[model samples]
Target chain A: MPEITFRQAIHDALVEEMRRDSSVFLIGEDIGTYGGAFGVTAGILDEFGRDRVWETPISEETIVGSAVGAAIVGMKPIAEIMFMDFLTLVLDPLANQAAKVRYMFGGKATVPMVVRMPSGSGTGAAAHHSQSLETILMHIPGLKVVAPSTPYDAKGLLLSAIRDPNPVCFVEHKLLYKTKGEVPNGEYTIPLGVADIKREGTDLTIVTSEIMVHKSLSAAEDVSKEGISVEILDPRTLLPLDVDTITNSVMKTGRLLVVHEAVKTAGWAGEIMASVSESPAWDYLDAPMRRLTGKDVPIPYNRFLERAAVPQEEDIVREIQAIVSNQY
Target chain B: MGSNKINAAYDNEETTDARKKAAELGLTNEDLVSMYEVMVEIRHFEEMATTLYGLGKVHGTMHLSIGQEAVAAGAGFTLQDKDYLINHHRGHGHFIASGADVNKMMAEFLGKETGFCHGRGGSMHIADVTANNLGAQGIVAAQIAMAPGVGIAIKMRKTDQVALVIFGDGAANRGVFLESLNMSSIWDLPVVYLCENNHYGMSAEVGRVSGKVPFKDRAEALGIPGYFIDGNDVLAVYEFMKNAFSHARSGSGPVFVETETYRILGHSKSDRNLYRTKDEINQWKEKDPIIRFRDLLLEADIITVKQVDEIEKKMAKVIEDAVEFAENSPEPNIEDVMEWVYA
Candidate 1:
């Protein structure tokens, strides 16, 4: 095992999968000769050649469409939409065609394609470039949506998504690309629809994903000083959500708070809330489920406002304190 | 004049063999009669849908493939049970021509539970997997890119089935369609790119908007043989599609069939016929594929006028029955809203 950045883990996953299966290929804008926007597939073209690592036109729709075509023909295509904000241009093929093809064709057709998008805000990419739309993808059926918070999960999840029998939208947080964690060197897979309990607690369960999971975990450590044991649950897969893990955590803690970088209005937090509220965990609740999400507005360019727009460590700590204090 | 007669006599033999082959392939007699009825079935469905839209029975704007019936019928008839088809917004003709349950398609347009997508998908998103017709998409050229993928799957599984992708000339300019063509050609996938060059993309004429090259020529450049055909001639279309399908099934790769056709109605129900000349519209109407095919069958003595009438009556009854079935079907259960979210 070695400490690797989230970007390295993704690159390793591509390298391993491409070597393991000849059908695996990479296609995106600036991915081939130019590496990638975030450098996740940097040096892959040199390793895999131009055939496996395909440089595509600036068209986002074509990137997704070509991937879908290649994937259907038994080529495991890993398509990268440079920015998550640009995903709107190609959602028709992803949501309607790639996602639904298998089910629509009575499980006869499989779009074994992975669409990797660098998502979230940190470097002032403005409103257009920085937005978390994981919930929107989670809303679509027949799609496996993943948001990995660590280098370990990123490597394993990417491998699993590539081998998946359905289309997967792998949302890699733009801010987490350089973040490092211990990632195993050999081939490994983290099954989709499973939740990982990063830290265990009995007071309150903090359900979050992607970079927010790291924020929540850091806040959990600080919140522990005040005698509030915070349980952190990362739902790596959004679509086939780890509802059972989430419910079990909530049942043990007797309280829940969901945090995400996506906007509060109709974010994936709503689904998490609704799921827990309707589940057996409802009987164990000491307080109403709380949601600490990004403010319901475009991410402002100002550093402070952009930081305040999403959930920060302090925000998670304060929410935990409020829940434990039982204060209105 | 007597010497010209000798040359005419010599050419007649080749023409007679072509006619005979076309007849054997269900392009004549009962098959021709059935195809005409199918075209009329789609025609009446579009007209009724248009009327329904005018009366506010339908909610969204719909693109009707009214004059492009032969393209749908001809290409659709070639599809077997295992073959796949991806259609565009003007896809009701494709759906009906491919044997989609008519009433469910109508019910879907009406937003009834009896609709194909259980009323979730309206006119622009009707699909029947049982018929191997992948759903119609509202996005231009999105399905064109996807059809090649299905073709790839068929080829990978060592199946002889082909995927038929139907898009408009407007969609031909889309990057996804071009990329799909490039991939299909390189991989030698079993797919057919059927471009219905109806001369207009909503309001813009194809010649004015397109980059001054015929869509077929573009396909040819991509290493796929492009066949530009009179989409109004069902027999010619059938012959061309058969050859294309064979080439694809035999692993020779994809073919582009640019069917030169027109939309008899406006882009949608709301569109008035103000974009083009009424004379141009009448010209295409005079060459109506359904009527033209009917005449060809009658002239060849493959079918009688009365036989054609009977087929039309039977098809109308079938459509009527489908409508009744849809009307009587139940709406999807409220809990089912979250049912298909996984699996």
Candidate 2:
């Protein structure tokens, strides 16, 4: 095992998959010669040649639609939408055609394609550029939504998504690309719909994903000194959610605090709360499930307001402490 | 009589040359008869469907391929079992000619459990995977763009099969259609794009929608060979399709065919015949493919009027039985609505 940044891990997954399966190819803007916008796929063109590493025009619809077409014809394509917000332009193909094709054709057609995008705010890419839209994609029925918070998970999960017989919306947190973690070389996959328990505690179950997983874990360590133990659960995949892990954590803690960078209104946390409340964890609840999410506002350019719009480690620390203390 | 004489004069030279070519290609009379039967089957199926819809038995939108049956019939006759097909909204003829279960197709339109899609997908979306009828889409030109991908897969799997995509004249204007054509041409994918130009795209005439460049010329501009044919003539359509399919099967890239025909009905069930004049309708009706083909078979003494009537009666019975079966079949379970929403 060796330490690698999240971006490197993703690049490794692409390289390995392309080498292993000739059908697998990469297509996106600047992904070939200029590398990806995040530099994750840097130097891939030199390795795989121009045909496999396609440099597409800045048409999100064309990129996604071509991927859908390629995937249908037995090519496994990894299409990169430069930014997650730009996914809006290609939603019809991804949500309507690629996602629904397998079921619509009665399991006769499978769109084994990966649509990777750099998601969430923190890069000062205000308003239109910075958005945490994982919740919106999670709401779509036929897509498998994955948001990996670590380098190890990124490599493992991207491999799993590539091999998945369904369409996957793989969201990578923009800020976490440079974050380093131990990743084993060679083939490995982290199964979708599984949650990782980062820190175990009895006081409160903190459910989160993407970069918020890292924030929650850091906050948990800080709150542990204050006599409040927090259990941090990272739901690696959103659609086929790991409800059992969160429910079991809630059963032990008797308290749940859902935290995400997405806006609180109709966010992925709401689905988590609904799933938990319907399970056996409902009887084990000591308090109402609390959601600490970004304020429902467009991320502004002003640093203070931008920070206020999303949850930070301090916010998670304060919210979890208050929930554990039962403070009003 | 002068027009007939000229047509006969051209036929003498063309048919003699075509027969010589057909013999060189080892095409038997059985193959010709089978091809003719496919065209008749497709025409009969669409006519029955249109009649049922007019009688208010079938619901929702229906885009009949009555006049353009020869295009689908000819192309489908050339497909191998492993070959794939993607069709547009007016796709019943394509599916029927490809040997999709007639009962399941009728059941699909009736929204029944016995439908090809288990009643979930209706007429425009009917799909039979086992038969390699990938699916039909309502979106114009969308399916044509995906044909190259199917061709790519067949090539990758080392299967000597090609993908046949059929769309209407309206689809040629779409960017996806051109994009897919370019990709297929560049990659030399085993595919054929059959553009059935029935002269209407929901009340807008083809002449109004498209510049007067002609459909086949568009393909020629893309550096691919294009074939223009009278789609009403089944044998002519078949001959052109056979040439195209063989070219693709031999790894010579894709071909484009423009089938000139007309739609007898409106674009959909809600459409009124307000766009065209009564004289125009009567003119095209006189050229009705089913009637024309029946007359041709009668003139050639290939079969008696009684035999033709027997075929019609048999197809009508099949349609009626399918309708009854669909009417009796149960609706999809409400609980299952959320099941297929995910993988």
Residue B336's lDDT within candidate 2 is: 75
* lDDT (tens digit, per residue) of candidate 1 on B1-343: 1121101111011123434657566554556666777898998788777777777766677778889999888887887777887778889988887888788887787767767777777788777765666677777888886765576557545779888888998898787777788877877878988988888889877877766545777888889998777788776777788889999999999998887888888887667777789998999899888887777667777778898778777777776676667667776677666544334
- The most accurate candidate by lDDT is 1
Q: What fraction of the reference interface contacts is present in each model, in order? A: 0.25, 0.27
- lDDT by residue for model 1 (A1-328), tens: 7899999999999898988997788878899767898888888899878657767656677668767766655578888999999889888889877877554433445578899999999989899999999888888878889999999999999999999878899999999998999987678899988999999999999899999888998999997888889899998899888999999999999999999999999998999999998999999999989999999999999999999898889888888989888973
Q: Is the docking of candidate 1 incorrect, acceptable, medium or high quality?
A: incorrect
lDDT of 2 at A282: 100
List, residue by residue over A1-328, the lDDT tens digit for candidate 2.
7999999999999999989999988877889767889998898899888668767655566567768777876689898999999988778678777877666665567788999999989988899888989877887778999999999989999999999878899999999998999998668899988999888888999999888999999999998898888888898999799899989999999999999998889998899999998999999999889999999999898888888899999998888877877883
TM-score of 1: 0.76
- How does the DockQ of candidate 1 come out? 0.23
Q: Worst 10-residue stretch by lDDT in candidate 1 chain B?
A: B4-13
Chain A TM-score for predicted structure 2: 0.98
In CAPRI terms, model 2 is classed as: acceptable
- Please estimate how well model 2 matches the true structure, expressed as its whole-model Cα lDDT: 0.80
Report the C-alpha lDDT of model 2 over B166-262, residue by residue, as the tens digit.
Answer: 9988888877766677767766778888888888888978876676535777788777888777777666677787788889999899999887778
Local accuracy by lDDT, each model = 0.81, 0.80
